[model samples]
Target: MSKNKVHYLKKLEIISKINTQGLTVRSVSHDYNISVSTIKDWLRLYDSFGISGLVPGTSIKYPNEIKMKAIEDILVNHLSKADVLKKYKITQNSVLNHWIKRYNNDKTLKQRGVGVRKMNKGRITTFIERIAIVKEIIASDFNYQALSEQSGVSYQQSYSWTQKYKAHGEQGLQDRRGKSRSSDQQLTETEQLKIENKALKAKNELLEIENQLAKKLLEFEKDVTRSL
Candidate 1:
C-alpha cells in the first residue's frame, strides 16, 4: 500500500524464499506487509515473464489469434487454467481470466489488444455500473445483448463483467489483469469427468442460444416478407 511499485530484486527475494525455502505466501506477506495476492502475482509473473513480469506497469500484448486458440484450448480442448497459462506464456492469470470471461458469456472469442490501460475491448465503466449491469444480466438469465443494449455498454463488456460476477462474485469484476508454472498434477477420474462435463455444458448452452436466435431471425424475416 505504501509503495506503488516494488523493485524487481525485492520481488525476486520474496519469491525465492517461497520457492526455495518453502516459506508460505502468508508468512512472506506478514513479514513484508504486502498483500498475499500481490506476492502471488509476483511469483506468477516471474514464472511467465521472468523479471520483466515483476516490473510495475509492465504491459504485454497478446495477439488475437493467440488469444482465440488459448480460449479454444480451455473451453473445447479441456485444458486446465494452469496448463493454458504455461502453453501460451500468458503474463498473468487475470489476462486469461479476462479472456475466459468473454468466451463464457458471449460464446465467442473477440480479438484483444495488448497494453495495461487499453487492452480491454470495451469502453470504460465504473465499478458500480458494472455491478448493476452484472446484476441485470443475471436476472435476465444472462441475456447479455439485451442488458448491454439497455445499459449502452458494449455486449462484450456486459458479457465479460457478468461472467466474472457469476464465477467470483463482485470481486471478480475488479480488473485483476495480473501468473506461474508449477508442476502439473494428474487429475483423478472424477475430476476429469467434471472438466469434460463443464465443457460440454458450455457448448450445449452456446448451441441452444444460437439456435434460438436463428429461429427468431427466420421468423422475423418471414413476417417482413408477408407484410410487404
Candidate 2:
C-alpha cells in the first residue's frame, strides 16, 4: 500500500477505537501520541467519509451536479452554510462561497478553456513574470489573450493566473501542481472530505452487496454438487 493509504488505515484504527471504545479525542490522542487537533480532524473525516475518507494520497473531485445542488440548497432553499455543509458533507464555507460567486457571475462549474493552451515554446514561466503578465491583463480590463501574446505566454496561462490572482491575490500565482494541502488549503477540508466520503460510501455499499452475492453463489454451487 502507499504510505498515505497506510497512514489513513492507522488513523482509521484510532478513529474506530474512539467510536467503538467510547474514548474521547483527548484520551485517544494521548494513547496514540498524536495531537488532539489532528485526532479531532481525523474523527471528523471519519464521520464524514467513513474509512474511505481516511484514505490518503487521493485527490477528490466534485461533479457539477453536486456543486449545483449545494448552491441551490444555500441560495434557493435558504439553508445556512453550516446546514448546507452538513447536508452535503462539505467541510468548508469557502467552497459554498466560491460557488455562490460563480453562480452570481454566471460562470459554469466547468473549468474554462483558458488553462488548456500550450505553453510558450514549452518553457516554464517564472512567478514574477506570470504576476507581471497577470497584472497587465487586469489593468487592460482582463484582455488576457492580447496581453499573453505580448508576454510570450499562453493566453490560457495568463487568463488563469489573472483569475487566480484576482480571487486569491499574489499567493494564488504559486504553483501547487503536485503538493497536497491540508483540508484548509485552497478548498476547505470539509469540502474535500464530503466528496471522498460520498464516493467511499458508495463503493463500500457496492462491495457489501457483491460479497453477499458471492456467498450465495458459493452456497448454490455446493448444493448442486451435493445433489449431483
Global CA lDDT computed for model 1: 0.67
lDDT (10s digit) by residue, model 2, range 20-92: 8899988887877778766765666567655545555333455444666677777668887766766777645
Model 1, span 1-228: residue lDDT tens: 543477766887889899999999999999999998778767766777665566567787765557766777887789988778878888777799998788656533442322111233367765556766676666555655545656777656886787787799766766544413222333356755554565456557767976996686567546644643
Pairs that clash in candidate 1: 44-179, 92-178
Task: List the RMSD of every prediction in angstroms.
Answer: 23.9, 21.1
How close is every model to the real structure, measured as TM-score?
0.38, 0.35
Q: Which numbered prediction scores highest in lDDT against the true structure?
A: 1
Model 1: how large is the Cα RMSD against the reference? 23.9
Please report the candidate that would top TM-score against the real structure: 1
**What C-alpha lDDT values do all the predictions have?**
0.67, 0.61
